[model samples]
Each structure stands twice: as C-alpha cells, then as structure tokens.
Target: MNRSSCAIVYNGNLGSEKFLIQVRWLERTAREHGLHVQVIGNQELIPGIVDGSPVIKGRYEGQEPDFFLFWDKDIRLARHLEKMGFPLYNRASCIELCDDKIRTYEQLLNEGLRLPKTLIAPLIYETCEGIDERPYETIVQELGFPMVVKEAFGSFGEQVHLVRGWEELLPLVHRLKHRPHLFQELVKSSYGRDIRLQVVGDKVVAAMMRKSEHDFRANVTAGGRMAPYEPSEREREVAVTCARLLGADFAGVDLLFGEDGEPYVCEVNSNAHFKNIHDCTGVDVAARMLEHIMSKER
Candidate 1:
C-alpha cells in the first residue's frame, strides 16, 4: 500500500491553547513518520456565503484526501465525510454509536458487561409531562438519591452533575426537562478517581489514573490530575472490549470502580485527546496511532 496523505479535521475557530499544542504535535508526528498531514477546520474546507449558507457547488472543490483524522469538535461532520467515501480514522458508524452516552451504556449492558445501574429518559413530550406532573418524592424514591444526571451527549465533564438529595435533583431535572438525560448510580466508593485507557486497534497503548481532590468527576479537563497507573487485568479486558464493541479504531474508555470493587465502564470517546495520555505515560500515542493506520493500509 502506498503511504497515504492524512487530513486532520479540527475546529479551526477554536482558540484554545491546548488545541494548538495538539495540532502541532500531530503535525510533527505525521511529518516524522514520512506522511503528509494537513490540518484544516470544517468551515474552511466547506465554504459558506455571507448569510451562513454553504456554497454547495463551490465547497470541497478539491479532491478528498486519502485518509481523514477527525478530532472531537468536527465529529458532527463524520457522516458527511462518509458519504464522500473518505477513510476516517474512526468511521462514522463507530463515532455515532460511541458519542451517545445512553447508546454506549446500552451496548455495554447488552454485551453483559458490568456497568453502573443507569436509566435514560428520552426527549419526548409524554415523558416530560409525566415527570413534571408526578410528585418529586415519587421520582426520587424510584431512582434513589446520590445519583448522577448527565446529558445524553456531552464531553469534557461539562454536563455531568451529582445530586446528593432530592432538593438538588428536582430543580436540575426540571431545568433539563426539555433535553435528554440519563441517570447513573453514583460510584461513591471509587473516591472520585477513575482510570482512562487509550485503546488503538486491539491494544491498550496508554493508561492513566485521573483523580480529583474536591470533586466527583475525574476528567483531566475538569481540573483533575493525571498520574501513571496500570489497569488491572480485568480493567484492561473490559476497556478493550468496550472499544472493540464500539468499532472504534481508536478510543478512550473511562472506567470507574464501583462500590463492589469492580471496574465499570463510564463512557467511551471516539475522538479521544492523547496529550494527557502521552504526558502521563511518555508514550508516543499519536505516532503509534499513525503506525496503526499504516499497518492497516498494508
């Protein structure tokens, strides 16, 4: 197989310092491996007119690249790229299934994996009206207190909230009544720490222990600190299984230890950030990922 040129799709409008660093790192790795890499934003690649209408005829005038490296922010454009027959690192089907928290939990559950007890409420008028009409006490009695409410699709620990009691939960639910959310049994025994494992193909390339001293969330983007840690055999097995089940060529599996001292999958990300993983493990994850792409070509 000929060496393929890689096009990285990221949100070019984003001015985050971390994003810049990651783009530079990816560019350096791709160049070092003797592969051509170009980074471009979605808007730039798909041009639009003054009224924010896409110039369909003029857009994407150039031929599509051999392979596409889709970063997180540009994930919504995966299906469009798929229609163009582009080879995305993590394919559109994989991204669609893995991006939805509710669907991801369902898939893991159907596979008979140990996961936190979860319940999902769809964004429907009937469900919303029923919850609003019912007594708050009745709702708490069924789901219990100290549960977690999360948006069906969210990342970077932005939409996850722990409700200690009825007072905290009722208002939140009422506010988010219009949006789809899932209730997960809180794993308090884990002590606000979780393991993040990066899986590329069938291998676990890097792992880290993320901990928060003051909060229940352990995402590094949520002010959590990352440290070197080896996952237990069971943890690795489950993480790898989740990644494979999601059909992700590359993924990040977030595992939280339950009160029963078992690792439960919290979520799976299709476009996982590798900066923390590389920093914590000193593993060239990006390079290894590119190597995986090359090997697949062969």
Candidate 2:
C-alpha cells in the first residue's frame, strides 16, 4: 500500500492556538490514514516567477507533494502552486471568493439565494483623499438604522460591526471608508444566533448552532456559545448548494434564520476552523477532510 503525501500550507504569522490545532489534527489523521504529511507556512514558501517560470522559493529540491491542503488566505501562493500542476483543495478562486464578503454575497445572490439586504461601498484607492457624504446618507436611507457593516476580507467575525444609528454609523463608515466594506440590513430575527454547517464534499457532516447573549455576531470567537444542531432538509440543501456553488471541496456555511424560521445564506468559509465544530459535535472534521483528499487523490 502506497501512502499518499500531502503538503499542508498555513500562514505562519497567524498561528494561533486554534489554527495550530487544526494542523496538528491533520497530521495525526494523515498518519492514521497511512499518509505522509508536511506542514509548510506561506511565509516559508515564496511563490514567484523565476527565469520566466513559476517557482516556490523555499520548496525542497525535487520535492513535490501529491496534493496541497491550503489553509491560508494567501491566494498568490495557492494560484502559483496550482499553475505548476499541483492539486489544491478548495482551489485558489474558491478561497478568494470566500475570503471576500462582497464577492461571496455576489455569487450567492446570482444564484438566487436568500440573503439580508446589502449595499457595497464604492472602491476608494489609498492614493485618493476620501469618499463624499452622499453615499453614507444613501446607505442610511436604504438599510435604515441598526445595520451590519463588514470589511470585505475578514474572519472570525472580527471585521463585522452592528451600527445602531447615525452617530455610530458615521464614525464607523469614516474609519472603514478607505477599506472594502458593505452595509447590510440587520437580520433582527437571527440576532445573536446563527447555524454553522460543516460540508465535506457533498455532505453536511457536522453542524452546530451558535448564539451570543450579548453580541449580534454569533461566531464563537465573538463570545458565542455552540450547541450540536440537526439541520432541516431545507437547511441541508441550502448549505450543500452554497458549497457546490462556490466550487469548494469543503466549507462552513452559516445560515441565518428569518422571522418564519426560513434560512438565509449568511457567509461561506472555505478554510473554516474545525476546532469549535469538533468540540461541539465530536466530529473529527480534520480526519474527514483528509479522507476526502485521499479519495480525490485516488
């Protein structure tokens, strides 16, 4: 039996305890599955053009893994690796779509998925001075008071904000105006709560309901509690469809509830942290991900 080899790529600078745990589990699971795995950081492996050919600076000589399990938002390296004929899980484009909130919602809306009303801020370059007050008033009029503001690229709900009225909205907007952000009507029914469904391949392997008593955002990193959840047929279909639409091998699809308990696509995470889901549901998402990779390699 020949063991498959995998290169797990991550961001060294963001090696939080939670992130490292995922990598450790992947290695342990790989060994259990009769596989060889090497952990590499995006900073260590520099992707660039050398002699007019794509090359990774820190890759060992004559060393190429059977596949790359990319766990970082470093799309450049992921793209370079894919361009060099290395199989990448989730693919670079999928990761990019998931990393940018605006892009994710755009794709979901195009597919006619239910989502909260949103307004994307205009793009302003760093070289420019700033945006006018006209758009802010327009956003306030459209989304009204108590809206959600989010930076296009962020994780763990850190970049998401809940603005109550003009006072809070203006300062927040001024601060984030230079950055890529969006305004969304708050899903009041789903306030302080949401569902996270872990999709591996075509299946929703694990799921949990996240709720925060003091916060509107339901991410565990944002002080939300997690509980095991059994999704309904509609929820399951919506999650699977979101993952498929994003061309992801696996993803964490969040569903927000409407007044009538209907599900709305919140956000899709391509390299979603599996530690919280594993702790809540006792499902080894890392092992399942490795299994999916093995199957694909075969």
TM-score for every candidate vs. truth? 0.88, 0.96
Q: Model 2, range 1-298, lDDT digits (tens) per residue?
A: 1247888888889757888988788778888988777888889887778789887776553478888889899998899999989999979999999999999988887675788999999887888776688988888889888899999988899999999988898788778878999999999999999999999999999999999999999999999999999999989999999999899999999999989877999999999989899899999898888889888889
* Runs in model 1 lying further than 4 Å from the true structure: 1-3, 47-60, 73-76, 125-139
Predict model 2's lDDT versus the native. 0.89
Q: Which ten-residue region of model 2 has the weakest summed lDDT? A: 55-64
Please, what are the lDDT tens digits per residue for candidate 1 over residues 154-207?
Answer: 889999999998678778887787887888778877757999999999988899
lDDT of 2 at 78: 90
lDDT of model 2 at position 152 = 94
Angstrom error of the Cα, residue 145, model 1: value is: 1.3
**TM-score between candidate 2 and the true structure:** 0.96
Q: Which stretches of candidate 2 lie over 4 Å from their true place?
A: 1-3
